[model samples]
Target: MNGVQLLLVIVGAIAVSGLAQRRGLQPALVITLVGFAVSFIPGLTRIELDTEIVLGIVLPPLLYSAALNFSFVSFARNFRPIVGLGVGLVVATALLVGVFAAWVVPALTLGTAFILGAIVAPPDAVTAVAIGRKLGLPKRVMSILTGESLVNDAAALTLFSITLAGVVGTHTLFANPVLLFLYSAIVGVAVGLLLAVVATVIRRLLKDSGLETVLGLVVPFAAYLLAEQIEASGVLAVVAAGFAIGSSSSRAGYQTRLQERQVWSSLDVLLEAFVFAYMGLQLRFVMEDLTAAGDSVWEIFGVGLLVLLVVLLIRPVWVFVSFGRHFLLDRVMRRRIASDTRVQERIRVENEQRIARGRRPRQFPVFLNWRESLVVSWTGMRGVVTLAAAAGIPLALADGTPFPGRAEIQAIAFIVAVGTLLVQGLTLPALIRSLHLSDPRQEEFDREQAEHALEVAQAASAGVYQRFLASPPEGVPPELLERMTQMVKRQSADAARDPDPDATSAYGEAFGTLYREVLQAQRNAVVDERDANRLDDDAAREFLEQLDYQEAAIVSRLGYRL
Candidate 1:
């Protein structure tokens, strides 16, 4: 498709996806299936798009925005499992798949198979988080999935590079793979840290929300570009920079928090929509190769099955073995009994007298739950990175002939991606329900903590009001404090309300109507301003943009059509 046509397609896709999501369906799934259907049309079949443009240009922003919005405290607390799944699991899965592919596919070399393996290792953060959030999985589960998706790309890319080097005979696979890994990792980490530190310093000095937010955008690209220039994993650098910014900026203050949240939140939605839509657009290019031969199709299907089985089976086994070895069978049984015991009084007594006094209760991170494990397993749905890596594969062999299985590999990779995203993504909710896995009370506790925070904010505002009563600012109006006090109180009360109200019932309908009216009024005002010429071209555009954003936020939060 040409530029204009692509833009139109994207706009249309976003509109449809938004509508579908508003109707309580998965937006990614809708967009992908729609894109798949659209691509099948005769006129649209010949569209040529750049995969690098999608991955390099489009992906960095989405990844960075996701990392920025992720809860730093939750990520930190669950760092072990996140890292174990993110970095360690990517490496392990790649190695296992590489060995399998090499052994099974006769014409493919070990390096070539490793390249294929690495391509499919990292899952799409957008898809994983969207489904997880919709399924009402615990925040900890989302955290691990998000964290893993954020960083696994780096590991996959690193492995891809090493495999690439081997493919070109630039380096032997056995020759200093460790040094290559170390070099890329150290440089990426250093670049990310330097960029983050500089960005933090600038934020503190400027203290302007717009400027700080704008600077925050540059940090990710800066890290990515600098790391790439120095022959390192750009993805790793961006992820590290994101973690640094998120952790550091939280310590800055309320203004930083508010501004950063707004910036990332807005960026997140646009980038997410664009990335998934782009992933869907790839169907136009790969569909022909996918449908070529029945045998070829079976090979693709078999590879996808192997990948799905490996991803699902390996992680749980790894978790059980890892956790099991650390704790004895007797200890495991006792802990399980304690956790599952229906008699709260007896459990509490045992805990106080025997378990609490002398024996320390075994502690596991919140992300270690079976619910999280299932989500993590299902989340291994690959996207742009896999396609990009496969496309980047060199076309020629050592003897200057064309590479063997190039078309087959691309087709297989596409199948694996689509299968995981479409089937596994859709089925995950049912699987979670079937297992009777639910988030622990900790998530409810988090809501309460947020409520307390809002209360503190309201109390602080009231204290400011009292201080202003004692002595007001030189030019400030006295009525300002009263108005601010009322606003703060309303906000606090809203925050204190229960967040888990049944959405399909009367409670949801009540709040839904209230929010829908508020959004509609805001939208009408924007149109009125535009028509009345009160807001000029630029001003009206800005107002409309803000209005659209608020509308979407209200819809997402309330699950009500506007």
Candidate 2:
């Protein structure tokens, strides 16, 4: 597509997504279907992108935005399940799908079939996560799905490289696939951490919000390219960098934080819109190419439907087995702890010790209930990555002969992707509603913690105004000083009685430094609650965002950028 066409498609996709959202429909499904219908409108050119550009340009920012917002604490808490789905489930799904594909298509070799398997193995959970967020799915479920999306790409691409090598008659990148994966993961993490450190240092020194946001835009691409250059997993690199930067985000200026959030949020919507639109628009051309290659499009599509079924079926089985084992084990452990007095005493002592050390008591593993499992199982939808990987497949084999089933594989991949988006994505919200999944316990905990967090913030700011008044800054007018002292007294009294208190006074260029100090103190207190697990990360983040906005307004009104 030309530049004009691309712009038109993006605009149209965004408009469709907005309309779908307002009508309580899944935007991804609506956008993809709309694009497909538009493609058949007579003479539009094929919507295609270079595979390298898709992987390199389109992926990093989306991943980075997710990583930045995702709490490191939640990611670690759900680490096991994320790994199971992201790595273990992805590998299992690829093998099963490959087996089914080869059996159904006699002309395709096992190696080539595996290539198709790897390409479509990972479900792009972006749409699923977005739907869950809107529908009020449990926080833990959201974490697992979000974390899986981040890690699965790396796993799928690694398998893609391995299977692609086998089909192309080349030596594997490493003798042992396990070693290859480890090398990719380890080196990728290292590259991300290294770049994060450098980026953090530069961000601190820059001290300009606009410049910092510009740098934020650049970091994801740089991390991806640098890691890929060194044969590491670029996906991991971008994620790691995002996590590290996010952890230290509080140290950055408020304007920078606010601008970065808004910028990335818009970028995510724009990119996702473009991706689904491109997926739909290319379907016609993919079918045409298959026919030109002497492959029956209908036959290949039928096989792809079966592969899609395998992809859909394998996840629930794996999730149930893995998660069920944990659930049962947790039950057995709980019974034992309850039955044995000695064990109970030991646990009590350990809890006391942890409390003494200012740590939360050790939390037992809380596996998902069956309702949650069913919802998570049904959330498997595929999107742009699958199409991109299929497109990246080389057209010729090692001896320069045409790749046997290239067009057919691409067609199959597209079919599976669109099919899943339609079948699963469209129905996920209704499934979630039917299940009535709600976490009342977590809700109560969040309420209690939010109150405590508010108190902590008030306490932190309690002495700021007093300190300012006791030893007033030079050049203070007596009248203004008296006014400030009275405001400070009222704030103190309010903090003592009010559940939510405003501890900062009026803003002015002269008091800019004072406001900064007050804002910093409140932010630190809230972040401390977050670190201590007293406050939910999401709640803490929302509070932090308010503080950032307040500070940004102050800075803007002062006619200066910090």
Candidate 3:
């Protein structure tokens, strides 16, 4: 694809995304099927995607954007479950799938089968995470899903490397797989930390918001490349850098935060849409290769379907065993250790409402109830990571005959990825509806935010009023100054009372509506001035930026991020 084709794809994807958003559908799902349909149009050939470019150039920023939006606090809070699914479950699934594949296909060696397993093991939840969050999936569930997606790629990719080495005669370095994994993890993390520190320092020195965001873009790719150069896991490096930089976010200004957020969020949407569509865009090639493999289409699909079922079931099976066991054990031990004591007292108090409702007290499994486990299991949708790994598989073995069943393996991997997206992706709303998970603390959370907003508003207003009363600015009328102070007090107090996203708080929306009207009035006046030649175009633009900034601040603080 040249410049024009690439541009057309992006525009097409964006158009599809906009339409999907309007109809309450995931762009990845819609665009993918459409792209596949378009691929079959008369005389058009699909562009063969280079695995190196996809993995190296395209992946890091997407991963970095995901990491930036993820919360370190939430990740640490649900550390065990995320790690269990991301690393333990991934490794287990790879092993089981590899063994199963080798059993089903006698001609396929264990090593080659393992490569396929690793390729599809780690689930990508970019689409699910977005849709789930929008559908009001609980914060904890979203956090776990996001956290799992961020790290599982590193685990699967690492295993992919080890297994690939065995297949290609580079197995010497991976003789002890444990040491290789350790080296990859440690070095990746170290390099990530190094880049994060340097990036943060550079961000501090640069006052321009645009320049800061530009540096932010470089951090992820830099970390990934530097880590990969040293034979470490580039995925982990980008993740680590995101976490570290995100942790020090206080060092950034509001402008930088807003700018960075917009840029990364847009990139995430675009990349996810582009790559998923690319999956379908390459379907013709996959089908052609499978037809040439001397097997009926149905026969190949049978194998692919088997692999798909394994990928789908493996997650829930693993989750139930590991997540369930640890949950039960932790609750039992905690109950015994703190029986009738401080922690127990807190637990009882926390569950008092449930008790009042004639329900049994909740337990440690609250983080991932059985219902959540089912949903998470179902949401293990594969995206770019699986496809990239599959594409990276070598074309020929050491003897140069052709890697055994390369097309077959790639065909299966892509099928499972697309299949999972179709089955689980399409059914997610139904699953979430069935689960009916609710955030019991949502009201309390909103109340806390409202109270904090009030306190901050009060403190700032008092400080400003007191300071200005003692020493006023020159050329400022006393009446105007008094009016301005009074207005601030009124608006801030009203905003506190009406903090957004709480349905019960009508005042927030009311104030927001009025505030918007005011901004629009200012905008109208500025346009009038510009129309009358009282304001130059450049000056009008400057004024417009300020208005936009103010409007963004009000909306962001007074409403949900969406």
TM-score of predicted model 3? 0.78
Which ten contiguous residues of candidate 2 have the minimum total lDDT?
494-503
The local lDDT score (0 to 100) that residue 366 gets in candidate 1 is 32
Listed in order, each prediction's TM-score against the native is 0.70, 0.90, 0.78
- Which pairs of residues collide in model 2? none
lDDT computed for candidate 3: 0.74
Ranking by TM-score: 2, 3, 1
For model 2, residues 76-149, the per-residue Cα lDDT tens digits are: 88889998899999888888888888888876788888888888888887888878887788988998998888
Give a tens-digit lDDT track for model 3, residues 193-309: 999999999999998789999999989989999998887888889989998997666446556876887898888788877776776677677777767877566777888899999
Model 2 Cα RMSD, 1 decimal: 3.7
Tell me each candidate's RMSD, in Å, in order: 12.2, 3.7, 10.9
The true-versus-predicted C-alpha distance at residue 125 of model 3, in Å, is 2.2
Candidate 1 has a TM-score of: 0.70
- Give a tens-digit lDDT track for model 1, residues 424-480: 777877877776555577567656544433333344345444554576435435655
Q: Give the Cα RMSD of candidate 1.
A: 12.2
Question: In candidate 3, how many Å is residue 377 off?
Answer: 2.8
